[model samples]
Target: MNSSYDSLVDLFLKSLRAEKNASQNTVSAYANDLNQFFIFLQEHYRKKADGIELEVLSHYDIRSFLAYLHRAGYNKSSVARKLAALRKFYRFLNKEKLIANNPLFFINSPKKDKKLPRYLEEKQIEQLLALPDCSTPLGLRDRAMLETFYASGIRVSELVGLDLPQINLDLGYMVVYGKGAKERVVPLGSFAIEALQNYLRRGRPVLLATQNNDALFLNYKGVRISVRGVRLTVEKYVRRLADSLKISPHSLRHTFATHLMERGADLRVVQELLGHVSMATTQVYTHVTTSKMKEVYDKTHPRA
Candidate 1:
């Protein structure tokens, strides 16, 4: 609302990109969350007996904002994310000496409901992989892309950011830059390697035409594919394969990790493959695998 608010957010976002190496999506989410919070503050203080300045903002004001979000029908996860944005913003202000005290010090994010990540069975994955036609150039690219997701369990952003130099088809692995721009080597499966090889030999060159782009995956225009493009490709086949299935490109990633864990892969190894900074994030797949086991036991166990 105010120029000062805008400037502070801009500075904070710059630090996130420059210092923390945050992704564009992360920066945009934080910006949107902060803007929403500021808008609520403007309306809130407008009705108050005394307008509260940013420097003098307290935990009570933060709680009031959370209450407003709840009343406005924001889900717990969404409210928690907004709260995180506020906390980070206030911390930045305090560090910059723009504010004397951080009002969000006592604030806590809302507890989220523990929903297990969705993953596909091997049969479903096989069915999904078969849906992409490899006869055409775009089909070849989509097949390679889908194979890569399941093979490496990489995030969509990382996959789309791939360059010609990052992949070593001969070695059966590729280097990917994950969150915070961290670099790691991910191994590719035989099926993925073959698909990628076919795309490179037949599909990619046709799409490349006269263009000189070094991007691993290119659109018909010969430019690197966008994250949205990859998602749409994944969605098209997923919808064709099964209308009831709620799968995204990320679901392929989930399938990758879940399948690995189901087969007794170590938690740390799965974490390393997924490029997770924390093991806790990778541990969720363990639950998914366990749930799957329980379901199988219920169906096949004679004692039950």
Candidate 2:
């Protein structure tokens, strides 16, 4: 790797971790995204990765890199994300006085298509959650995790980051540390609370064979369950019911938000519960529940 590029990449990621308090996942994604651009720069200029000097690159050079991505058959969304990563890296260079010119000034990101998030019907969610056998230790943990996913509407990262100290079963709330280390207290339903209590009493202790681990969910190794493990656990049941719809832990989070909006939960409130940094992020659910919103309007509004 080039001396300048390596230092700048390290600094950028350090800033992401220290200044923004970005999660490990975010750091890893940004590293991957930026490294991909580095590889593109190497290949485009017919130079080794360490030979490409980003500061000397032109606007056309950057645009060509983007063009290369398009030619490589990257999807619009993926390309946009890569572009975003590139833009941020350039901005970091600008801020650090490392570059003479900002090549991204002339570039614009492609417009993103509006795509509604996929969510399961209430019955589908019920069936999916019910598929876990709660009688066994692993089954109890899986049940609790699913219940919490639906009840809290948290990101998968937040789910796996949970510890015993963060949850308040008696108070029926949990402190979720979200993106940028922002904290929000989310309420839990009776079902989730009961599942958690049952798991804590019956399932967790049995799985708690290894000492000194504080994670709320554990695997057979008595280690904290990983995000992949959580996905696989969700997929096991999703596959049984996976006829037409796509379902994952993310789908469960989407289902939580959609169901809340369908039941007339306030948009801002849902935003807070979900720990979304912006109301605009939560507004997509309004679009998803357009039919339900229309039903409410038709039933209540005199004009309808």
Candidate 3:
């Protein structure tokens, strides 16, 4: 890209980090989306990106870009995400007076299909948790991780980001830094607390060895475990329990929320627990529970 485009993109990304507290993954996604848009502009205009000013771009250009994405085989969700990224970028530009107005301000996003989040059955969760052998260091750690996931409906990123000070075993709660660097306290269940205590006292030390890392979870090399490491550990145990299960650590999060909703937990409370900024995002679990109730009614109701 040319210097002008690079400068604007960098400035916008910096704002996302400094102002919005966007994560690295989020910033990178915005960057990728903006770069793709600029490339499309270059190809459409048959000139370098330096010649295409943000001021001259209209809603038609934005619509054309969406059309191009669709033609290039982008799905509705993918197109929607790209459009969202562009919308944000353009909004930032307008705020900074780099553009007179946001071209995407009036554009509509494609509707995304409503797909229910996958969750484990209570029996399956119990079986998966029991699969980890507590006697072994890795097993104890795995048990704690699994317990924590089911106890707190945090994202996988928040789970892997946990540090020693974040967890309070005595109080049965943990501090979580969720999206946008928002902080929330999530309660840990008795089972999770016990598992965590065991890991901290026995498993973690054995894994830590001589390492001075302050991470709550560590890899075999005695360092902080990566997100990929946690996924692999979960996958290993999941495969043993059921080869066709096809669930990730995230499924445990869904299970946590679903179980709570089934037990009459309030929607607003669940939203706070899940650290969802919008109640709309947490509303999906309602559909999950409602569907389950319908299934149970169909089976148990004599009149039906």
Q: Give the Cα lDDT of each candidate.
A: 0.88, 0.87, 0.90
lDDT of 3 by residue, 1-304 (tens): 8789889899999999999999999999999999999899888975455524677777998899999999999999999999999888877887888767677878999999898998899999999999898999988999999999999988888988899999999999999999999999999999999999999999999999565677898888778888999899989988998899878988888999999999899999999999998999999999999998999999999986
Return the clash pairs for model 2, or none. none
Candidate 2 lDDT score relative to the true structure: 0.87
> How high is each candidate's TM-score?
0.73, 0.68, 0.70
Per-residue alpha-carbon lDDT of model 1 for 201-230, expressed as tens digits?
Answer: 999988995556889999878789999999
lDDT of prediction 1:
0.88
Error of 1 at 82 (Å): 6.6
- Candidate 2: clashing residue pairs, number: 0
What's the TM for model 2?
0.68
Q: Where does candidate 2 stray beyond 4 Å?
A: 1-75, 78-104, 291-304
Root-mean-square deviation of every model: 5.8, 7.1, 5.9
Clashing pairs in 1: none
